[model samples]
Target: MALMKLATTWERFILKDLTKFGRYAKVELTPPSPGELGQVVKGAGGFVKDALTFKWAQATVKEATVNTIVIAEIACWFFIGECIGKGSLVGYQV
Candidate 1:
């Protein structure tokens, strides 16, 4: 009985460790492809340009709406970068 208990404990420990590693492996990341990298660089510039174009000196409701959209677009770009970098685009619906 004691040997059985020891075996079970060791198994639990090993399985727990393996599960943690498996979780980490769920998102295997590869280096971005050349095209993806280029897009990321270009997207960063577009983000900066959009922010600069906002007329901070004359704040208005319309500009605020546009700013929100710009934020969403930048967020999308970042998501794109991550997906492409991780090579996780397989069967992913964007």
Candidate 2:
């Protein structure tokens, strides 16, 4: 009986999480239109300007940690994609 109760709770939690994810996916999974692409370019330019001024050097520890994690995640994904493309974990199968 306890095992069944645990499974029921887990199912409920998973369903709740999936609903939340679906809400975000609807908004975030779409490709940007041309106007949005222009805005993205402008925002990136502003970010580059700040970096040139060493503005990021003054970030709070929490913000710096978050940024570092994001960069690391991107690097990890890049390597994972390369491995998948080459069909090898260590080196290309040449």
* lDDT per residue (tens digit) for residues 5-94 in model 2: 999998899988999999999999999999999999999999999999999999999999999999999999999999999998987898
Model 1, 59-92: lDDT tens per residue?
6889878988999999999989988977786555
Q: What local distance difference test score does each model get? A: 0.84, 0.96
Q: Which runs of model 1 end up more than 4 angstroms from their true locations?
A: 1-4, 16-20, 55-94
Q: Compared to the true structure, candidate 1 yields what TM-score?
A: 0.39
lDDT of candidate 2 at residue 52, scale 0 to 100: 100
lDDT of 2: 0.96
